[model samples]
Target: MVRPLYPINAPTYLRLRDQIRADIEGGCWRLGQHLTLNELSAHYSVSNVPVREALLQLQGDGMVDMRMNRGAVVLDVNERFIDEYFDIREALQSMLMTRACQRRGGGVLMQAKVLLGRVDEAMREGKVRQLLEADHALQDAIGHMGDNEPAMAMLASRSRLLEAFRRARLDLLTADLMQLPVQGLAMLLAIEHGDPGSGCEAVRRHVAAMRAYMKKLLKIPEGRSRADASLVNVPTFTRARESTAAMPEASSTEPASPAVASPGPPTVLPLSLPPGRRLDPEGDGSNDNRSTDDGLHPPKR
Candidate 1:
């Protein structure tokens, strides 16, 4: 009965899907674990129908497998999958590079700065779940500067999953997640200089670094195999069916702007994002000193 930090006006199934995903990415839902509809429904206090709907949605994201014996189970993701995700992400981000450069000379980059600051704030204060949400918001703002709706849409779909991948990587990583803001800043700088090629290259390096780290963590071998091992005994990934419910995209458009911060050496981060404790819906999240969740809110339609 806790409210989501970034609440979406959605059905029980969709909200349940988010919780299941949060559990999975937060390492609560283990690999090869079966997620039965009856079990999930019982846990979330919802009907089986909605639980089924949520699992179906997860299936499309490559996070769930509907096996004959196992029913709906969490899939174990390997390096190739991570590589492909980053590859596509690189291409999409590249598509936005020129536009981002053209759009972000003055106030716009400051928006990204504030979000980055929130990342530091969230991390410093031990609000790791909020940090993940902030990461997505920051990237979305960078994407917005580029003006490519289709690419942005794809990024939005994978945002939560990307955050999961990132957290899992950090758990195995010694360095900080500063690669994000560092490369993000590099891309923005390239854009400001009106050099799309440089911006695209920065994106390439950004993805490559993450991919390298994932490979190291997974203990995947150095060289590419002659044939992709994944295809040989490919588990039948269900045809990527369209999801029934989607998180509303988070976005920002404001009249005032703050100064953009320069990226520096990364500070160490905690290994994992904590399980999300629901905010008291009846009560305002808190009367703490930090500003409201405006920077973290999911974009309104």
Candidate 2:
């Protein structure tokens, strides 16, 4: 049997590497932020060796540039960089869609449906983490749809670049604007209906929407947008509420009303009377006023 690849839980070196990469992606290590081995060691509670190993990983990912004497500084998202990243993303998405079309009508379609439900839930409840993970799941599923190992690896490598863009601008965009999940659903419908053209068009539309949104964010024209200056008109907190109110209802397929259980029958308990007190468990007091058959004078002690 073929050995499975090591997971994210490997030895210290791999774990540290994953952590540092996550930090950079999360913007904790901002652009031009110099992260030294000593600082990383102190922050991560690991020795310099693992930190060094993690830094090497970042260097390989092109997120860190090592200076002569200054150690590693994170790369800034420049205009050229954004343009190149989007160009590459457009190509990868197209290729992945074509591959998916070839391997249609199976588990891939079912997985897409499941992911679409998750996305709808996230949108209805405004769960950001769920939406984000759903996005990754859709991408991973698509990458697997390629079926061939070589094709899958190629697409996976390209998808990482798009992920970096997503992470960089997560704050700028709202959950509603990140509609990849919906696009995935549409693509699934197109594929399951045996329409390769529709599938391709669906994927193309998804890619185009992302490109247009990113461009709008940068405030530059479609093709020449600059990353540094790109920002959408962010509504104030009050206006945000107004916009949500103006929005339409959620999906028709959301969960139905939940059923609640009614209270059960009241509990019964045994009782004991205190000294000199007549038994009146039911509060009738029938025996209190009347004398018993053999009573002397109600037990004078």
Candidate 3:
């Protein structure tokens, strides 16, 4: 399983990492695509070292293939990918359910209930991004209950792939996608009932449903242009004697600020950004073919 460095206010690489993950999952980069490191560095207005590091993180998550000749190539989603993802999701979630049920004194129940409230509110308001984050928070609450690092790490990778596709093509996929809170409800019910089977089965059913939905979409031919994502022009990269990261500004008399602890549990999965910029991160995020301005980038041969 791939691990994320503890994000302290999210470093430039981590920030870039999440930004890119969101783009890929949100369908800005399309299903089958690839991008070179120079292309990405120019688009994000950051150095390629962070870009390379971020892509490495994505590679570990099975989100992309880092080829010597091809650089970063996006992997197409299909049935095999769905099955493998669900299989991993099931195993880790079952283990987490077992652990959470064993130790019920960690206030996991109350925390889950609160997160569920947030999920419900996000859905009611039709905020896709907020809803997605809330759903993951509910899952994190459960993982924290279990206190299982390995299970959480593996689960995070499997889920990033799952959620990325779901978020990207949500509207086209279904008229009613209400399973987010339903799954959370099932887990909460199991916790209250002290039965891991119910929660485990709930998650299993959810993954199965997602697989079916993905299969249905795969049958249709999507025509979103991968080449239209041409980004800001950047110069060729040089490998030797690159400058170091800039030091954070500090005051001579002022005391340094203490780190602000995260209010929520550490997210198992982080967001993704894409090299191609056909989809504007600031726009409505529609699936129709379009282009972004200076902030993002994409192009094809």
- Tell me the TM-score of each prediction against the true structure: 0.58, 0.59, 0.59
Output the number of the lDDT-best candidate: 3
Which runs of model 2 end up more than 4 angstroms from their true locations?
1-11, 45-49, 124-129, 148-182, 215-301
Cα lDDT tens digits, model 3, 77-189, are 77888788778777787778777867762676776777777775554344444665777788788877888887777777657666656544422213122356556666666
Give the candidate order by descending TM-score: 2, 3, 1
lDDT of 1 at 263: 79
**Candidates sorted on lDDT, descending:** 3, 1, 2
Tens digits of per-residue lDDT for model 2, 136-204? 666567656655566555544344434454555533434233455445655665555556676666666
Superposed by TM-score, candidate 2 places the C-alpha of residue 30 at a distance from the truth, in angstroms, of 2.2
TM-score pick, better of 1 and 2: 2
Question: For model 2, what is the C-alpha lDDT against the true structure?
Answer: 0.54
Q: Runs in model 1 with CA error above 4 Å?
A: 1-10, 68-70, 105-107, 114-138, 165-182, 220-301
Q: What overall lDDT, based on C-alpha atoms, would model 1 receive against the true structure?
A: 0.57
